[model samples]
Target: MIKTIIFDFGDVFINLDKPATLRELSQLGDFQFNNSIQDLNNQYEVGKITTEEFIRSYHNLLPQATEQQLIEAWNAILLDFPKYRLDFVKHLAATGDYKLILLSNTNELHINWIKQHISFYEEFKSCFDSFYLSHEIQYRKPNSDIFEFVLQEHQIQPTETLFVDDTKENTDAAQKLGVHIWNNNPKADDVIDLFTSKSDLF
Candidate 1:
């Protein structure tokens, strides 16, 4: 009875080195991933700050790092979008069996980089019935509002919807709202195995 699938963009589809950003930033002189930076990132993810403001704020914090360097480090977390994953989703979309939606907590810089680097980005996007980016939507995962928004926007029954996210916090949040979930482990889990992996739901 699962009529809809909500997918997380990072890790679930694209490869991300979650710690890579901080690892790259540590190369900059005396840089620390502190609470202020974390708060700034959260704000940026929800579109509270513009990309220029985000870079400028980081540059202010780490005076030793140039804006371009900061941008490069920030984008280090994004690695690659595999062709097979794109093919899988595209095939799924072609069947029109379920409502496909993409929900990701990402920022402008990250998406801009994908558009530039991932040649099939547009094709990948077309696979989804609705694409919701945290920054663009002014909401983020692991929060009730974003989940509620998606559910209400689509008029999808929680019992008939499955949310797949690499982050447990996000899946847990959706689960609380009665949605079925797959807390996928990116290392061992491939989204293309959706039917076999979560066969009980389908």
Candidate 2:
């Protein structure tokens, strides 16, 4: 009896090399990604800081790295968005069988890169009934409040919503609120097999 579906945008849709950013940064001249930088990233993702401020922080940490270089390294994690996944989502949207939502924990630079690189980005975005980007919403996942906000905003029952994410941490947080979850492994699973992979829910 699922009436709403919530999807994560990163690995669930666009392919990502999770280690690419770190690898790129390490090569950018003595940039040690310590807990401080991770905190800064968390802050940036939640819209707590501006892009300039983010870059400035990085610049402060690695003085030798230019702004352009830092920005490039930051965006290295993003990869291509497969056409088949877009087709599947477009078909799903056309059915209009359930409310479709996209909930992602993303920052400004990554999104900007996608906008420039992914030709069908706008078309893909149009498929969702509601799209919640972390920086835009000022809320990121792995926290119950964000899920609560979504549930309340849409007036949807947690028991009737299905949240699909590539991260176990995010899915676990959603499941605590009584939502159905598919913690997909991007390496072994493609989102197009949603129904077959979790058929019991359907």
Candidate 3:
């Protein structure tokens, strides 16, 4: 029986236009932004750099842009959180059918943006038994260690925990640790459908 549900925040719950942000950033300066931006992003996610440092690095690259402008542009990836999904997750939590948890590979700037925009963040997060953030934990997704840490911390049997993530590699990593997973592809499938189909398990 699945007694626990793990959810990824970005893309899975909140919408993110990753490619759009990259494209916009690439056009910001005389120099071209390529795969190296991805490397910097990975480093930020893994807690190798602070948000201030990340913003400063970008500002240095794009000397023509102000710090505030660069910061806003960096956070442009976070679009909005739909109300329906928030309601659905709240409904699931209210039922008391499972131990809910949220795990996301998010950085400080993105988190601050959410705090400023998403009014229901506290309410939604309160519904979960635990909320884990990469920056806070100094660990990020697609890393087997992070998955193992959650399992160990919660004393959850991997087979009885279901993880939903937008990234394939993150899901794959959790699967390797024996957790049931759903790859939430917004273009193909929505999370509500997944919950409805797997209602019996909950």
Candidate 4:
């Protein structure tokens, strides 16, 4: 039986404009986002570098951009958390039917922005039995080790868990480790479709 539910935060619950930062940064100056920047992002998400250093890395590239401007552009990717999703998750958590866990590859700036804007963040967070944010955990998804860490830490069986993520790469990684996953398309499917979509497993 599926006893645990692992969820990815962005696009799954919270909305994100993944390209918003690139657009905002372009407006500031000639900022090129290539493979190197993606590496820095991976490092930043896992708390390998400090927030100041993360911004400075961008600042170093686009020296013309001020710290405030860089910070604004960096945070543009994070959008709002909707109310209905919160309600749905809360109801699921209240049922005590399964162990709910949140696993997200998120950085400090995005999280801070959400806290500042979303008043009910704490309440929504409380619904999860285990909340794992990449920055705090020092590990990010699409890496097998991170998935192993969560499974080992919680003594969760991969076969009995359902991992929901909007990103295919992330889901693919988890599936390799024996976890059943729903590579949920944010455009067509919502996390609220949990029981109905994966009814057999439930």
lDDT score at residue 99, model 1, on the 0-100 scale: 100
C-alpha RMSD (angstroms) for model 1: 0.7
Number of backbone collisions per candidate, in order?
A: 0, 0, 0, 0
Model 4 Cα lDDT, one tens digit per residue, 36-93:
9999999999999999999889989999999999999889898878899999999999
CA lDDT of each candidate?
A: 0.95, 0.95, 0.87, 0.93
Question: Which stretches of model 2 miss by more than 4 angstroms?
Answer: none
**How does candidate 2 score on lDDT?**
0.95
Tens digit of per-residue lDDT, candidate 3, span 30-147: 6576688778887898788988889888888899988877877778899989988898899989999999999999988889899999999998888899999998898898999998
Tell me the lDDT of model 2 at 71: 94
- lDDT by residue for model 1 over 110-168, one digit each (tens)? 99999999999999999999999999999998999999999999999999999999999
Worst 10 residues of 2 by lDDT: 28-37
- Which lDDT tens digits does candidate 2 get at residues 1-202? 9999999999999999999999999997886777888899999999999999999998888889999999999999999999999999999999999899999999999999999999999999999999999999999999999999999999999999999999999999999999999999998999999999989989
Q: lDDT order of candidates, best first?
A: 2, 1, 4, 3
Q: How many Å off is the CA of 20 in candidate 2? A: 0.6
Worst 10 residues of 1 by lDDT: 28-37
